[model samples]
Target: MNRKNLTHKAGRDNAEPVGGGGRIRPVNNPREATKTRPAGGKDAKSTGIDRTRNFCIIAHIDHGKSTLADRLLDLTDAVPERERMEQILDSMDIERERGITIKAQAVRLVYRREENGDGGEAEYMLNLIDTPGHVDFSYEVSRAIAACEGALLVVDASQGIQAQTLANLYLAMEQDLEIIPVLNKIDLPVADVEAVTEELVELLGVDESEILKISAKTGQGVPEVLDAVVDRVPAPESAVEQTRGLVFDSHYDAYRGVISLVRLFDGELAKGDRVQAMGSEEEFEVLEVGCYSPKPTALPKLGVGEVGYIIAGLKDIEALRVGDTVTKVEDPAESVLPGYAKVLPTVYSGIYPTVGDDFERLRDALQKLQLNDASLFFEPENSRMGFGFRCGFLGLLHMEIIQERLEREFDLDLIASSPSVKYEVVLQGGETVEVTNPSDLPEVFEEIREPMVRATVICPKEYVGQVMGLCHEKRGVSVGMEYISTKRVQLTYDLPLGEIITDFFDALKSRTRGYASYDYDPKGYVASDLVKVEILVSGDPVDALSFIVHRDKAYYRGRAMVEKLKELIPRQQFEVPVQASIGKRIIARETVRAYRKDVIAKCYGGDITRKKKLLEQQKAGKKRMKQVGNVEIPQEAFLAAIRI
Candidate 1:
């Protein structure tokens, strides 16, 4: 390698000749490379001028998301000096372990396709947003989809379309983005392109010609899909005003405080702009303004149709709300932000510390989570299980993920209550109540209106009997059941929102296996004989243990909940009563039998270590629980009962 070659190399790998297209060649002369190599070496791609694109892919899980990304990197020559397929983008630790996308990952690639209508077959940046597929991570999916103007709906040719696939597709449509249907998994023998296309036309109501057949695994049809994305997905029509941008997402950065993910709806973000977001009056001289292709880098400016990150010189994430508008301090944008939707905090749950003294850690985790999720609302609320937070979530999955994240990410043990739906009630004294906790229920008879849900169940016509039976069991009133085709039927029900929420959907699926597809929306509230079945661990009522059920269903519901609690509730030093009661009458009762074996007998040798460990474990366990006379209360005992 000569000095002239080292001049272009700038940092490392002087012996590795630069390819014609500015790609790095494999290191041939180790000595020359070693001599020129900079301290840790530079990112071959990241070190070069960053390629930028703003787009998100929408597909069901297992429709070759990460594989498609892997192929793009290869075809675009994004990887060099390593034969390793290297990263699969979403193949993060959790994703690889679980084989599911838990978070959205961003990356940059150049399709370098025939430009077609844009003058010449040109090279343009392609920003790929790969998101999660499970229902629990739908918020992450929605966030990723919103970042792109075009969504490539990857449908499995073999598996056909799934309920969740349609759910995401409908959301993409609702966002009014261009929909490009790609038939994935054509390499498999079971690939049914025709069947899936027909379903897309009939079920999704998409035009037949709009679908493209592709295989992300065999590296087949991927280029065509890329072409479809460019030709079909329109360029962003209008840029947001001169305002900075609205905070689309955010996260807590240990050193950077809160790093906000902002989509440039309009205007340009310069290096030193002071922006106002939410009600927060922090004037942040923009420390760094660049788009995140999953990897953050400094950029000159972000125009319309760009997704990027902002490092505001502030430590509090609460200042930059997810849905709040961002405006430059001087001469703010005149027009209001576009397509601003009211993201209501729907369900509420109590997130308690199972290990007892991790309350501060729980708050810290929540603060970090809230930095990215503006719609999440949580505050300190006291329960019988000591002090915990009554946290708001978008849905059940949101509640579960937060709990899981606290445990997995923060190493804080948690006991969570069944999610409680927000209720609207008219009190006897003419005051209407919106209650989250069942403990807030009015003791006296009043017009109580629990939220009602409108749900449509798609199932085999022959199974309508079982479906109807299941719905009726949940106190569901069927509007009608219509046959779409020979074997398929759509059943409409106006059921108590509580019924649909609590294990009902899971039960419905269990009853039908993976075949039934259901969709639901909140239908305000309706008057019903609602009562809070209070669960008393011994004589004291555990507010965290209460569940609001219709008077008609309370008896059985309470009985099952109490029965489950009995199996889980720790045995007491003395006999303990776990009972569910409505008003003054006890409806269900279960007992935590007296401790037959809580203490270990004295032992010898290695047995002494086990016995002493058990004794210490028992002592530590006592600190986590409330001892009522002889009765023992487990932190999860109350949460386990709600079943929501």
Candidate 2:
């Protein structure tokens, strides 16, 4: 590889990130920014790698890639059990409760070379990339595979091949990554190792003898898996070729500032050194350097083909993101490495302060979160809901996690809009207007296009009718349907992404008796009329009510959202008018009557302190409300409106 390849692009602008992973702000590693321009194109030059082993874990959800990693750290004595994390969730709180790795997490595992040769003095650095298996987060798996040379595919022996298991294998194959099959969960009584072996051979085209059977739950087969990684995954061409490293990820710690995750292709990183991120000017001292023991370990240096975390003064992880690079002392690679072409976000929502005076607090919480989740793009936004942020995420779950994080992690209350996809209106003049919030829909647009969702649902044949009925209710069209097994059918549909962001999936499953599984990907947009539909009680316009709907169904869904709002909202002293609109013009309208009675029904003469306390509580509650012009919008009003 030409060293100039990594250096030539030093002056060029950092490219955009595309697909489900999405883009983050750029941070140039100072060492990387000074590299000479590449002779050919933007690409990292290879480094010496007698110390390289690249591999990704491919397994269905709950197959325990994280658990296995925990054991790997302990088995290798990479870090004392006191320092290392048990499950490398690297995941936020929401991810753990949801039981999925929303983002692909990478870490370096240092294993002692006792099995292979050289009297076991040689230590092997295993770059372990854990990819998410859920279809919703499949894009994360793609990037994980891109950074690896091989895959340690874990399959449950009793369960054999799962839907996502097959999905991930297909992804791994596309990357041409060497596959080391491992049958896990052998600790179960019904574990059928032979059956799973045959299934793997037939489905993945792997030899039966190649599959290593293990019980990840019991720490079995982990050693063999680690050994296979060293033998099967070839080291980087050269770990000492050049001063090049790839910025595969970044995270922000309140105390550590910027913690950048990188794969060193050549050279090493040390403490008390000045360095810059690959794309931006954010510089930091090598506060600490350690392999992704998921625990902070103070190591002297990291060699090529190793994944490690760098804590710098630059705490904004977005700046030092995936597909970036690191170098020694302002000497970067010829050009920065490319991860995915660029990241594009499809789902969006509005987040606002639910209570008065918490606007700044909510904004602070969101900014703090953006420090870690670079994919969750956000900006200052003012809305009828309140002064807040308009955030973008990879998918609905991505959006939900950030919201949950804001509330749970930061303890700030917020009001959010239902998730929506960008709607592009290709006008007659070949121009397009992108609509995220329904309030942004252009006025009198001739041709409006909104996102259509593509979903694959698995439900029992007996409940097929129930599922189909639910689909039709959401105006989803059955484009294709197939039988996945004797009792299950996979149905494909195209619906508005907005329609199902809320309870559509839940309702589908509930109506079908929990037999339906739903997965969706945005399938572009369909041309339809959308409006800034506002809901009002009595005659007051409640800004919290908004939706993107076709002109045909706008009346019903709009009315439904308003009616539901009425039930959720407490009647006020004044009447409220719930009206739906397109710009200033009202298309449909509804109204909720004012409160007939609100004053306390009984007041005994003796309890003076109790009455004072009740009145104080009422005053405090009033302080929490937002004063929207003449309306004292209740805090619970916004929360109740979009809780789902």
Scored by lDDT, model 2 comes in at 0.64
lDDT of 1 at 41: 30
What's the lDDT for all of these models? 0.66, 0.64
Give one digit per residue, the lDDT tens place, for model 2 in 128-152.
Answer: 7777765556656765776676888
- Please, what is the TM-score per model? 0.79, 0.77
**Runs in model 2 lying further than 4 Å from the true structure:** 1-48, 77-92, 112-123, 134-140, 156-163, 186-199, 272-276, 281-285, 315-319, 355-368, 426-430, 458-472, 479-490, 508-521, 529-532, 577-640
Worst 10 residues of 1 by lDDT: 18-27
- Who wins the lDDT comparison? 1
Please give the lDDT score at residue 107 for candidate 1.
66
RMSD (Å) of each candidate, 1 decimal: 14.8, 9.0
Clashing residue pairs in candidate 1 are: 114-121, 115-121, 239-266, 240-265, 240-266, 574-630
TM-score of candidate 1 against the unseen true structure: 0.79
